[model samples]
Target: MKAQFPIFDICKLSRCEQEDIFISRLAPFLDKHQNLLLSHKHTFYHIVLFTEGAGSHDIDFQRFLVRPYQIYFMGPGQVHSWSFEGKVDGYVVNFSTQFFQSLLLKADYLDQFPFFNGNVAEAVIDLSTNLHPLILDLFEKLVHESETVQHLRQDMVRVLLVQLFIQMDRLSFERPVHQATAYNYTLLRNYQKLVEKNYTSLKLPREYAELLFITPGHLNALCHEVLGQSAGEVIRDRIMLEAKRLLTNLSLTISEVAYQLNFADNSYFTKFFKKHTGLTPEKFRDGLFNQLSQDALSLQ
Candidate 1:
């Protein structure tokens, strides 16, 4: 059997005695683990701030250019890969999902932050020159905290991390346009959560609407008004994303992938994948391998 797509957890990546969290200067971290250059998923929350670098990173198939003082956040299970042009150095912090659960009263406190909400566009942030020094200081403190065995070390790290998140959130440019009313936004978020949890088995808008305690028409209207897409489209996008993630694992056959995704059959799955991505599953996997090969060659 071929190798499965890489999914890294905090325990596997942590160099320190603390298994729940890992923090270090990005350059050495990258040097120590070159495999991170390839596509993989993380089982922990991944945060990076680039002080100096020129590169492109793909988060869930969306590519973004790297720049100085730019930071990116990734919630667990998001597929990402990096291609750097020159020496990359900054700060990187990886913490398990439970890192904050015990520290904070609210279990979903991280989810409240836009960066941790699993939206690639919102997760990557560019800080202004005025804010760079302040953000840099916070990261420095986090690095120092991680290096030393001080009193309340983990708590201090959590405080600094939360402060960093708030600082980024306060930036005017960081905010995405608010299209949904508070009620609609809450409802939409709930709907999205349900879709994420049940997408593999529930494919219809009405099914989700029933779960949301609203009519299908209401759900469709809300999705269009807030997301600029139909409710069905939103569910379809989630399903398609999972299909792509699964396809990255070369060991999984097309039929197996389809079965795992709860598709009717292999043919139907192929048609769906092709319709959305314009490439069959096999072709898509082949392209990924070719791209990885080219990337490896370029690095050499």
Candidate 2:
């Protein structure tokens, strides 16, 4: 049978009882939440403002230490979990992609923020204490607007979210030194978007380079300079991530997983998976289930 992961959609979770936006205090939210505090993906976006709490959060397999005056931004499709000691006091705001896209118009409008960048490996933003009031004020406004139907409440919420996004972008972690040039940055972002869209069918570095109107060598250099990974590695990583996702669904046979991922054959897919992840497909899937079981046992 297919192993299923919980996908929390804001609209569904809200049950139309509220708007597409949902806000709650972090401590109580965590008290009622179990699945998402562990590894899970959301169908909508999450902006967490950690006014008080200290621990770690894992996003897409990368773990980040959490601190007060810190905020975390997670986009749709990212897998994440959090573990913190002691009381966690803060706010969590979840809004649907539809909620923002209806206002922004651009399909990839969210991509403009550095933390939301597809190529970015981390998204934690630490701000100075002085900025906490301003940040918290915006969050409070979002919560207030979500509760009552006021004139232009939707507009006010959108305005606050945009302001929060802009402020958070300013506080985002700095890009690598090599990403300074606007041209290189733009090219890199374009490549990332292309990879997300076409990683399954367009597997080769040259294919992406052709789409970007650049030589394979230039693309490779840009990838290495800005992301510290070769163009091929980035492509492989995306494929591997998808492979893992599929493997979690026990309903799919190994061969089926390979076929779904566009591999020519099962054996070749196993080789590719092992090369990048140091585990055969079967072992990888078994290991993941075993680890999940252990986590459940420990919690009990």
Please report the candidate that would top lDDT against the real structure: 1
Poorest lDDT segment (10 consecutive residues) of candidate 2: 171-180
Worst 10 residues of 1 by lDDT: 171-180
Regions more than 4 Å wrong, model 2: 1-4, 177-179
TM-score of 1: 0.91
* lDDT tens readout by residue for model 2, 1-300: 223555678766556765577888778778777656656778778889888878788777678888987887888887777778777889898887788766777877788776775433546777787888999899888888877889988878889989998887665534354434778878988998899889999999999999999999999999889778899998998898888877776778999999999999999999999998899999988876776666555666
> To one decimal, what is the Cα RMSD in angstroms of model 1 from the true structure?
2.3
TM-score of each: 0.91, 0.89
How much is the lDDT of residue 204 in candidate 2? 97
Steric clash count of candidate 2? 3
Question: How well does candidate 2 match the true structure in TM-score terms?
Answer: 0.89
Residue-level lDDT of model 1, residues 1-300, one tens digit each, is 233458888877875467888999999999999988988899888999999999799999899999999899998889999989888999999998899877899988876666776667778888889988899999999999988998999999999999988887666233544455779877987888888789999999999999989999999999888778899998999898889888888878899999999999999999999999999999988888788777666667
Query: What is the alpha-carbon lDDT of model 1 when measured against the actual structure?
Result: 0.86
Each model's backbone clash number: 0, 3
Report lDDT (Cα) of residue 17, candidate 2: 67
